[model samples]
Target chain A: MRTEKIETDVLIIGGGTAGCYAALTLASEAGGKRILIAEKANIRRSGCLAAGVNALNAYIIKGRTPQDYVEYAKKDAENIVREDLLLTMSEGLNRVTARLEELGLVILKNENGEYAARGNRNIKINGENIKPLLADAVRKCDNVQILNHVNMTDLLLADGRVCGAVGFHVDDSTVYEIHAGAVLCATGGAAGLYRPNNPGFSRHKMWYPPFNTGAGYAMGIQAGAEMTTFEMRFIALRCKDTIAPTGTIAQGVGAKQVNVFGQNYEKNYGITTSQRVYGTVEENRAGRGPCYLHTEGITGEQDKELLKAYLNMAPSQTLKWIEEEKNPSQKDVEIEGTEPYIVGGHTASGYWIDRERRTTLPGLYAAGDVAGGCPQKYVTGALVEGELAAKAIQKDLKESGADQGRYFAGQTAGNQAAAAIRGIYSHHLKKEPGPYSIDQVEEAMQKVMDQYAGGIGSGYRYNEKQLDLADEKITLLQKLAMDLKAEDMDDLLHIYEIKERLIVCRSLIAHLKARKETRWHSFGEHSDYPGKNKKYEKFVNSVLKDGRIQIIYRTLQKGDIEI
Target chain B: MSIRINKEKCVACGKCREVCPGNLIKIGVDKKAQIRHPKECWGCTSCVKECSVNAIEFFLGADIGGAGSWMLTKEEGDIRHWIIHKSDGSVKTIQINKKNSNQY
Candidate 1:
């Protein structure tokens, strides 16, 4: 295997939505600084925006203020959010949306030439090429270099400060040792950790991108960075088999959530996001086997609008509709809650960062879905976080002065970290076939999580006994993961993806046990504690210390506090 | 449903192989793109969109409302033309201009 060394002023991992924007911001503002983006796939179609989206879901429409957006997010999360992060993120939503428009994105405009508002906090857009546009803009920057098809395994740290990261090329055997003065992780969030809605051949058909395996969360957990709210997972309420976004049909045609009996049961539960999913589960349990978005009486024009909207974002849903020859006007779309996912963009579940997007570890920053405490940070919100982190990195690097000399001096440490990862790769390559294949191990992990950790199979509810069993089974899986062998580079990538998912699973189980209340309904339903407890209102944080997850509770940060 | 690559139309540009998120597509010894694992494909159509020559076609299985229909793409400048071939011998086309995608 070949080894390559790289040095950059700022290293941005996972060149998806946030990573691309962060690089664009740094390249423009931090003049002459070297910026490198290492992505698992090509940046033009990476992260959550790979297929594209139909609307900007976090904008402050007319008559709505940034503070109002903050309040909406706070109420949705049940007062367990970082108001500072939400406020800062909310304040930049329109700015970033406007920036995207300037970059050639097509935002739908009304007859008055203003942006066509979808709802109180969203505007429609034709964003199928959003990722490509961002990638194109970043490619124009002279100092930015993108490493496509590189899978980052671990972050390089010295004296508890991040110096760089280590990974290998997916198609080849080249190991990359990158040493940067500062690093920003925008790797998105974890999917496929729990059992998915579809099985076998169709397993990858889910709400979030199936490729996002929680690498950022895994690396940070291994490096002992504090994480928050793994228990408050994000369970998307989507179209039944296609798993497409229901927002288009709901907001576009003003469809109401109705059970099979044609009765509206949405308001019976609360109107919060979690409550919606929880209500569906309850309806099904109460003999209403199938719940749906009532679109029976919509006009043909509205049906065409729904089809066009989904085609711009999720083509599979549009294709399904076309194949069935039944439009929304004739058939109501069946809805179901997908498997729980650990995503900070939709729900707070990632690194505990301050307002400037700095994690507890120095020189290590996080943004986008990987940065916790800012929920409901849809596409525009992620762009805002990326900008915020880039600005912070510029200021911090300036204050610390040019540290190339010190960074180079840390080569010894970098070598040691690289050697450790190399050892694992070589060990896996040379090992005999174990009892279980990587696929088997991954399926086993998912089964354990589904049955015990509030996954879809268990109606998104878990008790202490189930969690204890989950912890024990997951620990055994981690041990088995170490012994699993890889036959080639492709197998190697699968091994690491499963390993990262396992690590996130361990952290998620601990957080689930630590928070002893059913705070967010089906998101984190604690069967043992069926009701929310005032004592458990604070954030449930954790850090891996001495090979064990240590739980820590932090008081809520309210209002727009200065850093 | 998974994607099937037509070797006759393939130029081996490797665009589809590079853009596949699952890394399921690879160039064979004959220098033609082949899917490594058809069952594992999620049918994202990223590869289909990237294949400029229409070498790749996504199979529309009977499971998700599609009964033996196939889909392909043809990009002409900024316009993307999505063509569908049905089992009943009928064809349907949807043309979308990348620049005016929001006009609807």
Candidate 2:
């Protein structure tokens, strides 16, 4: 009965690091035009920064080149990463890192005037928060209009390329096309695909923010963009279930991998080595195992020892600060539960783009954690990709003699992205009766994730049969996620978003299924085929095509770029 | 304009109404705090933080949030998010409780 259409020159899907940087990059150049940022939550409350991490890991300094960053990442990834994307990220890290203070963020400095960094990757600030700071900068910008709690339902395509996206306002329930000539998906990774140790908060321990859900890649796949390396998921291993690095006391803290004797057994099995991502996977493969999804080594006494250290060590930095803030304290922290699937970088589905963060479809871009490829899955990498994508777009538009400002949120005529959203929201799910509920559907999906998808003692231990079972359960969950009810427009969008995650999950499972010779060794954690092989599957990318996903192998020529 | 109360969120145990040093609120039968007319009501948000029901909302916009917060920028409020306590429930701040120097 009513028609609504609007357009923009560029559309960025996620409001995380990449999308925010892109918006900031555009801020100085473009004014008085249209730029619409549709975020699931407020932009400051985005992926990576949502839980307040203090640093960026992908920074490259004056002495360092992109080549060094690339080599470090490749070494960290055990030599299974794309050279071009990693190099591009590291080379551009300084641009993102240096601009934070310029944007009015008050970060702490040392006597040397350098920002505090840990693990030689992250930056530390005086304030114990990240999202609030990022949010403060974003709210001040004039060119951007943020629609928080808005979920992207579909993509608008013109002649088989991405033109824009269609999303629903979850808070009040209205739909907007959010059109732009070029689109970027910075939606971040999927931590919900597997069950994480942090249960009450949802399964997003260290992998990523919970709601990221691979929607960017879903947009890419739906728009028919080429995606790469979806299967190379990162699984962070920790001794305590604290997701460590968060600077908090665990329910218990001890070196992980205790033997049946209940002793510090990881060293005896020889797994405490550095730069070794897959040592544990190899151990489990040989059946010398901590072989548990939820096996943590910290006893109750150990938990008390670690928490007491935090409570008494540094009042400002310790549990006392949390206590003053009325946050949850270690009232006997849940040691690692019986299951352990800390799967990261696994939301393999996303807008397939180049090292420049340009999608295969020109004018459509992707960035942040949502942007596909590179040894991605960190804030710095996302920031680098975000900055690179913005530069590329800014350069392209400037060179083309095109006024990109005139094109913000433009018209879509049968623009398939809008039409798809129209069909899902206005047609398919809208016609259903009052009080349609997707809560039960989401709850059930979580239950399935906890039970079937290598979680809560449910994930297949890399066997053909278990993997096949995981596949069936995933398919069933996808159908349920789609057919589920929606009381409001946001629920439908969330349902649609769930459909995207299921796709990513299947792709992750497919890649996990395909890598017969486990190259990632310990961290990928699929121990059934756990022997490291350099010669067999050098570098593989999972590309979803024509209703089926295929893992094609391609190798870099020897002596291409020395580490 | 100042000290907005969500009646639905409030579970009137009179916690806020009781702790108000400024005597801004009084408990009503509806199980919510009734705000009396505010002329000299020095916008102390002590009652706001005291309410455990999460019924009270604070404002940063001075009139909306009130003048009470900026006025007391110097002193600690009557209520805090989490008051520190040694084994006994004595009111304490972040610094080691000098009163409870005997206790660990």
lDDT of 2 by residue, B1-104 (tens): 13556799878887665444323465667767776523212223445545666666532222221222211011133211323333233443332211110100
| Residue-by-residue lDDT tens digits, candidate 1, A394-435 | 999998995343465746776788789888988887899999
Chain B TM-scores of the candidates? 0.87, 0.51
Question: What local distance difference test score does each model get?
Answer: 0.88, 0.52
Instruction: Give the number of the best model, judged by DockQ.
Output: 1
Task: Estimate, for each residue in A1-563, the C-alpha lDDT of model 2 and write its tens digit.
Answer: 13345666666676767778777677656654455677775574445554334334455543557787667666655666656766776666666666766654444455687764433444443222344456567667787777666667567776665566777665355677666656767777665555554444212223344455667766666666666555555555432233333222311232344333344444544432221223444444456555322224435454333332332212222232232332222222212222322222322234445667777776677776665446644655666676778777777666664545544333445354466566666653555543435555555555555554445443224555666777888788776665566655545655675687777777767766666765543334455665766664455555667877777665654333321
Off by over 4 Å in 2: A1-4, A31-33, A60-66, A106-108, A116-119, A198-207, A238-351, A399-417, A427-440, A443-453, A456-460, A522-528, A557-563, B1-104
| DockQ, cand. 2 | 0.04
